[model samples]
Target: MGADRVGSGRGRVGRTGAYAVCGAVLLAGCASMPDSGDLRGVESTARQDTQVRVFAMPPHENASPSEIVQGFLEALTSDDTNYETARKYLTTAAGHTWRPELSTTVLEDAPETNAEPVGSREEGEEFVFSMSGSKVATVDAQQSYVPVTGAYSRPVHLTKNHEDGQWRIDALPQGVVMGKSDFQRNYMSVNKYFFASDAEAGQSPQPAAVADPVYVRRRVEPMTQMVRSVLKGPTKWLGPVVRSSFPTGTALQAEGDALAPDDQNKLTVPLNARAARVGQGRCEEMAAQVLFTLQNLTPAVDEVELRSGGKQLCSLTEGSHADAVAALTSAQEPDYLYFVDGDHRLVRLSAGSGDTKAEPAPGALGEGEKALRTVAVSRDEHTAAGVRLDGKALYVGALVSGGSLGDPVLRSEGKTEENRLTAPSWDVRGDLWVADRDPANPRLLLLEKGAGEPVEVETSGLDGRVRAVRVAADGVRIALVVEKDSRRSLLIGRIERGGKTDGRPTVTVRELRSATPELEEVTAMSWAGDSRLVVVGREEGGVQQMRYVQSDGSAPEEQAPTALPGVEEIAACQDDQTPLVANSEDGIVRLPAGAQWRKVTEGTAPVYPG
Candidate 1:
């Protein structure tokens, strides 16, 4: 950073006459001249001594008239006598009236004069002197003595004439203020000429101008690179077989879309405008995520409804307005709302009631009109993940508050760059736990609030691609599905406190496949209590069963799997131990602990969980 310098316009003038007088007086005795010059030199010596003694006397003393005059002149001319001493001499009204102009004139001409007097005093005292030859011509010459401080210096003049054997002063015929105006015109004119000449010659005698600030431009590229390194580094060095197992093409493209626009700028976009664009993008991304994840479903329109507990909460689709999207992903703490559609748009949503509006559509980019996606609500609702097609990656949106998905709460997105997120679970603190199914680098990602980036926990060592992930009732323990070659396994992991591996924190994983070695792979996992986790999977014979595992990595115990009656897909409640399942052919089912499963709703379409 640079700053401008402030200048105090002030100038100083040196008295050359005073220096000469002091030197001459000091060298008077040392001169070796002829006898004819010696007499004149002696008289000069006496005058010089008298002048020095008179100048040394104080002002208040009752001295002779000549002595008083000499002392006044010395005091005025001495550099030691500052502005304060000069002000004191101007005691009488007339003296005060002339002081400012007299001071200005003396200061301006001091350097040019042979010997400068401080000022003149017109008291009740008189002195008679005779001026001969050139002296008389110099006094009577057509020269103006313009006082620097007075009004007459501009266009004024002063003339002297011998009257009654004394020189008298009077204004010139042009009617100018003699002392002030004349001096001002000359002083100002000189300065103006100097400055104008320097400026026109392009000679910048002053300092340079300050520089401006730099804005952040490339955000998404760096973020994408960071994610790619974190997720793909270790596996890329593995054999080609491992790399081939990973999904490519559309998955990478979709991940790239989700991580777009990654830079942060000091200048802020309008909250309303940002909110609308992000909301629309979020809806589009989420709809794509959900529709793409489905086996064969294709969306005829860009909009969809978000449902909770068998009731329609809000629509996560775009409307007639450009900013209208049905869903948004956001964080609960420090409450940040972000759009999850490919563009990472965000805005802060305030607490209020009624329909929340969106921004207008963006301008056309090319020949085609871009589809604008936004989230809208009939009432308040909590938004979860928005997944796009081809099973590559999705945006995980979680609500942190105790409120149901139908209520407004904090929202956030869990993003994956290359791995496909098959299942996601949220802890009590709102941190997201996601399971990715890339065989070479299968892992669970923990997205914590305030963490600069998501942390990945490798599940490859546990033996399978994760099919489902769930946090225990205590929120610290987690359950995952691992498949080994052709057989599926249930792996229970406790959230480790101080354990770390390879500079990263580690979760303690304990295999629970002893009692259910016949089980192929876990399809879903949920917590039953603070110490127990419920696991669901199908045996080699294709019969699905539910089992329970302890947090300490204990062996598994068989528990009767809650029959969805006719539902095929199931999701556990984040806040409680109950599970909600839906049958593509029948209706929605709710299975609470120790209670027979009950049907929540029966509709033609499948009931989806947010």
Candidate 2:
């Protein structure tokens, strides 16, 4: 529906500038001035150009009530510097009180408006507008936005004054309403990184960066808004898992000051004195947070400088410890796709495999007696976790030389074997996540590398059993395949970590939002990007196929990519740019970038580092 590029809006500035220089200029020969000077007749064409953009203005003063209503709705889709033109159709009092920034309601298509001339339009009239086709998501007051699904309706009240028969809206909804295509053109998604509390709460060995994606106004000062959002802290769903390094009261030293990249691509941010008290370690952490957030913008910033009270308190470069923190946590694609072979042993297929032969992994687990049903590899590729075929046990061991698969790390406590456990997922912090799924004691558990017992994660509002669980690379959000009402639905739950008094960390999950409400059954899903997932399911009457859906249940205009035939299982990492791998009936197939899926002979339970 719109340009499919992520940062296409920024390209318009250069194109607009070129047009201003060539077309927006008036010829010097056409200029005439009353002067007696000799140069008056000999006109030199001096270059004088200014950027000009056409804007939608308010309706005429004598316009009918319906005309004014239509003009107002069209203006809502424009940026127009704080929606200045859109307010023209509103009464002076209403214009001053209405805030279009509070939230934005995304509609399926253009709204249908009908005006009812109440009492001959003397006492004023009302216009009712109804829109259909799913309402996707709402951006809240704090700019925290989540995916949602529903229908929406609103009414506009118009009044006519005696002096000038000008029809203007007196009251309406507080925020702006637009369609999905317009929202994509006017808004952008950005991920702001915050430090996970695992290390702080004694759960992990060190700190890791967690990414939280939010939509911001694309034409507005997005870099400034991104930094301000980071200082404001993570969204409500993510607040429990991550903590901002900036102090609580820390804010921009100058209000509305945007962080612009210098010639060196370094962003200098001026913060209040509240951040100056932190030591060098915390200062770097604060800088890392800003760098990771702002780097998502167009022409990404390579480094960050934190300033306070007009002095440079700290300057962090891209290769520094803070800049490297995020890279350390995210999973990178390995050279091989590791899985189990028909011999009940661990094996891998090389990236450039001309032959069909598969090689055994360099570890004892590859040659162990236990038959693995499912396997999950850690981000570092140094360790692997596997669940027994019977689902009664989980084993974790090393993937390097001199490493051996030892005793089962966790045993299922379910009364029956089928109710034992689901596949295990590993987070960046070297912790494993699994679901017991036992009807007797159905719950989620987290296993730290060296902890004595698996910590039970509190899951609220979970109606059905968690059939499958996958932790995002950020370690904040989790995707669960929940079986409820004899069907499966994809739900996204936030992971919250709390500090306990006994020096142990407490983890809980809250507000499980459905990502595929229209689908009657979702068989499998994997994280394709930071805020998106590729799900295999049946939507209403549609057949079971792989579709790309947002993490918040919102749908994009572009159709889903072609489904891989006969694929029973799929695997993708957090980085959406990488190719997707699937377990097909023929063999393991890999989808390269812009290429068809090709079969890689002989493997089961294929997995990428997550």
In terms of TM-score, which candidate is strongest?
2
The TM-score of candidate 1 is: 0.30
Query: What is candidate 2's local distance difference test score?
Result: 0.68
Model 1, span 1-610: residue lDDT tens: 0000010111100001111112222211122222111111111112232112112123333332223222333333322212233332222332334332212222212111111111342232232111111110000011211111211111111112224222111211121111121122111100000011101111222111100001000111322222232222112111111111111221222342322211321111111111232243443333322221110111122333332233332343222221222111110111111221223221122112111231211212110122112221101123343233333543433233332222112122324433455545554334556666665655667665313245776433465566656554223345666555767565555354345556555543332323234457555554433233445667777766555543333322234456543334444322222233333244434454456765543321111221
After superposition, the stretches of candidate 2 with alpha carbons farther than 4 Å from their true spots are 1-54, 122-134, 200-206, 256-258, 276-278, 320-322, 325-328, 331-336, 350-357, 400-406, 413-419, 499-505, 555-562
lDDT minimum window of 10 residues, candidate 1: 189-198
Judge candidate 1 against the unseen true structure and give its global Cα lDDT, from 0 to 1: 0.29
lDDT accuracy of residue 191 in candidate 2: 66
What digit string (tens of lDDT, one per residue) describes model 2 on residues 34-60? 211121121222212222222456666
lDDT of 2 at 521: 85
Q: lDDT values of the candidates?
A: 0.29, 0.68
| Cα RMSD of predicted structure 2 | 10.1
Off by over 4 Å in 1: 1-383, 396-419, 458-461, 497-515, 546-562, 565-568, 573-587, 592-596, 602-610
Which predicted model would earn the best lDDT? 2
